[model samples]
Target chain A: MKNMTMGLAALALLAVSGVAQGADDDHRLDDAWKAAVEDNEGVLSPAQVSGLNILAYESAVARLCDGIKLDEKKFAASVAAVVTGGSALSEEEQVQRLTAVMFQLGTANGLFLAEGAMKKDTFCAHAAEEKADKDNPHNWQ
Target chain B: MKFSRTGLACMLSFGLLALPPLHSPSHAGKTADAIAAGLVGAAIVAAASRHHKHHKRMYYDSYEPYPDNGYDTYWNNVYSPAAGITCYRAQVACYKANGHFSAKWTRMQFADGE
Candidate 1:
C-alpha cells in the first residue's frame, strides 16, 4: 500500500512537471515571435509575411507528421498581428499578396527544377545563353 | 550534290580572290551562317516573349481571389482554416465589416500525409 501510494505521488509529480515544461516552451515561442516582429518595426512586408506564414505552416506540418501537438492558432495569431501593424492593405489584400508571392516563388523553383534536372549539358547550354543575354546592357534594365 | 556545292563555293571564293576587295567582311554583308543564326535568335526571342506574356496574363487574371460578392464564406471555410492563425487574424482585422469568423481547430491527416 505504501509503495502504491509512492508511485501515484511520483506519477502526479511527473505530470505536473510535464505541464510546467510545456507552458514554458509555449511562453518562449511566444516571446521569440514577438521579438522577431518587433525587430521588423512591427510592419511586415508581403514577402516577410509570406516567409513567416510559410514557416508556421511548415512547422505545423512537421509537428503533425511527427504526431506532436501544436497550438497553430497561437503562432498564426502572432504572425498576423505583426504583419497587420502599420499596413494600409486590407486583410484579403494582404493574404492575396502573401499567397501570390508564395506561388510565384514556388513556380520559379519548379521551373528551375524542371529546366535543370538530370541534364548537365542542357543546363549548361541554357546557363550560357542566359549569361550571354545578361551581358547586354539593355537586358540589365 | 553536296560535294558539287562545296567545290563550286571553293571555286567561287578563288575566283573572287582575283578582284580587289571592295569592303571588309564586317562592313560587306552578313554570311549565310550569320543570317541563319539571326533568324533562329529572333524566333527564340519571339517564343520567349509570347511565353512570358501568357504567364503574366495568367497571373494577373488569377491574382484577386474575391469578387464583389465577397469572400466571407471562403474566408470562413477555405482560407481561414487552411491557412490557420496568421491569415485568420489578418482576415479578422481586414474584414471587420464582414462580421466575425470562428477559430478553426487544426485537422491532422496521417493516412495520406495531407
Candidate 2:
C-alpha cells in the first residue's frame, strides 16, 4: 500500500511538471514574437503593432466562431489591452482569454449563429496546430 | 484612382507656400514661415490621403446569404498586384435585415508586396 501511494504521488508530480514545462515553452514563444516585432523598422508605432496583433486574433476567431456574430468594439478593446497593457501573460494565454470573453459575450447577447454554424476547435488549439505546420507560415497579413 | 485636380492644386499651393520661408528675412517672412509650417502640415495630410487611395480596394463580388455557415465568396477586381485579405465580420442585424455580412475590408500591403 505504501509503495502504491508513493507511486501515485510521483505520477502526479510528473504530470504537474509537464504542464509547467508546456507553459514555460509558451512564454518563450511569446517572448520571441515580442522581440521580433519590437524595434522593427517596418512597424511605425506601437499602435500599428497592436493593430497587427488584432488582425491575427481576428483570423483565428473567424475560424473558431465560423458564422457567429462578433462584437467588434469588445474584441478590439480586449486586443488593445493585451498589446498596450504590457502584461507578462503569454501570447497563448492572451488569445485564450480573449476567446473566453467573446464566448461569454456571444452567449449572453445571442450572438452565435444557428446550431449548424458552430466549430469544435478552440483558438489556442488552432494556433498550436498552425505553429506546428511549417509549410504554412504565419505573418501580419 | 488618379489624384483629383483640386488635390493637385492644393499640393502645389502648399509647395509654393513652403518655398518663401527658405529665402526671405523680412517680418512678412515670419508669417511666411508660419504659412510654410502649415503647408508642411497640409502636405503631410495630402500625402497620407494619397497613400490611403493607393492601397488595396477589396469588396465581395458575391457571398452566400448570412446565417450560412460557409461563405462562398469571390473578391472584386484586383486593382493592383498588392496582397490583402478579405474577412467577413459578423453583424447579425445587418445580415438578418439586409442579407449581407458586413465586409471588413482594409487596404493593406503585404510584406514583399507579393
Candidate 3:
C-alpha cells in the first residue's frame, strides 16, 4: 500500500511539473515578442504602441463577434500610404518602423486569442454582449 | 510504471496542443513590408475608429483624428485596407471561437490573408 501511494504521489508531481513547464514556455514566448518590439523602440512612441495594442485587441474581438471579412489588396495599399506619408524617415527606417508596428499588432492579437481559448465561456459571453451593442461596429445587425 | 509514463505523455501532449502558435517574424522586404504594414495598419485604423465609437457611447470620450499635417494625405489610404484587416481579424476570431487551434490553421489564416 505504501508503494502504491508513492507511485500516485510521483504521478501528481509529474503532472504539476508539466503544467509549470507549459507556463514557462508561454512566458518565454511573451518575452521574445517584447524583445522584438523593443528592438525597434526608436521608431514608435509609447502612445502609438499603446494605441496599436488596444486597436489589435478590439479588432480581434470585433472580428470574432461580427462576421466581417478582410480584403488583402486594399489593406496593402493603405499601409503603403501610411509608410510613404512619413517621408522624413529613410526607406530603411520606414521598414523598421512598419515591422515594429506589425510585431505589436500581431502580439496583441495572438494574446487575445489565447486569452479567449483559456476563458472561452466568459470571453465569448462578453464578446456577444459587445456584438449586441447597436453602436458597436461589430454589430452587423 | 508504464501507466505512469503513458499518463505523463498524454499530459504533455495536451499542454502542447493547448498552446496558441507563436508568431514568426517575416523577412522585411519592401514589398512584403508594404503588405504586412497594410495588413496591420489597416486593422489599427479600423479598430481605432470602432473602439473610439464604442468608447464614445460608454464614456462620451473624444479620440484624436489623424493629424491634419501632410500625414492627412495618406489617411484616406487606410479606408479600404481597414476593411481588409477587419475581415482578417474576424476570420481569426472565427477560427479561435470554433476551437480550431492547430498551428497549421493559424499559419493558413496568415498565409491566406483573410
TM-score for each candidate, following the candidate numbering: 0.20, 0.21, 0.34
Evaluate all candidate structures by whole-model CA lDDT and list the values in order: 0.29, 0.29, 0.38
lDDT tens per residue, model 1, A1-141: 999999999998886554322222211232223222221211223334333333333332222233223344443343343333323444333333333323322332332333234333434343334224533111110
Total backbone collisions for each predicted model: 1, 0, 6
Provide the TM-score, chain A, model 3: 0.50
DockQ of 1: 0.01
Please write out the lDDT profile of model 3 over residues A63-118, one tens digit for every residue: 56444332333333322322223345454344434455555566666666665566
Scored against the native two-chain complex, candidate 3 gets a DockQ of 0.02
Error of 1 at B35 (Å): 51
Chain B TM-score of every predicted model: 0.18, 0.17, 0.18
Please, what are the lDDT tens digits per residue for candidate 2 over residues A11-122? 9888655432222221122223322322121112223323333333344344455454234444444333322331343433322222222222223122222211332343
Candidate 3 regions with alpha-carbon error over 4 angstroms? A1-42, A62-85, A132-141, B1-114
- Candidate 3, which CAPRI tier? incorrect
Q: Considering only N, C-alpha and C atoms within 3 Å, which residue pairs clash in candidate 1? A: A76-B86
Residue B58's lDDT in candidate 3: 13
Interface RMSD of each: 25.7, 22.5, 18.4
**TM match of model 1 to true structure:** 0.20
TM-score: the better of candidates 2 and 3: 3
Q: Determine which window of 10 residues in candidate 1 chain A has minimal summed lDDT.
A: A35-44
What is candidate 3's TM-score against the reference? Answer: 0.34
For candidate 2 chain A, the 10 contiguous residues with the lowest summed lDDT are A37-46
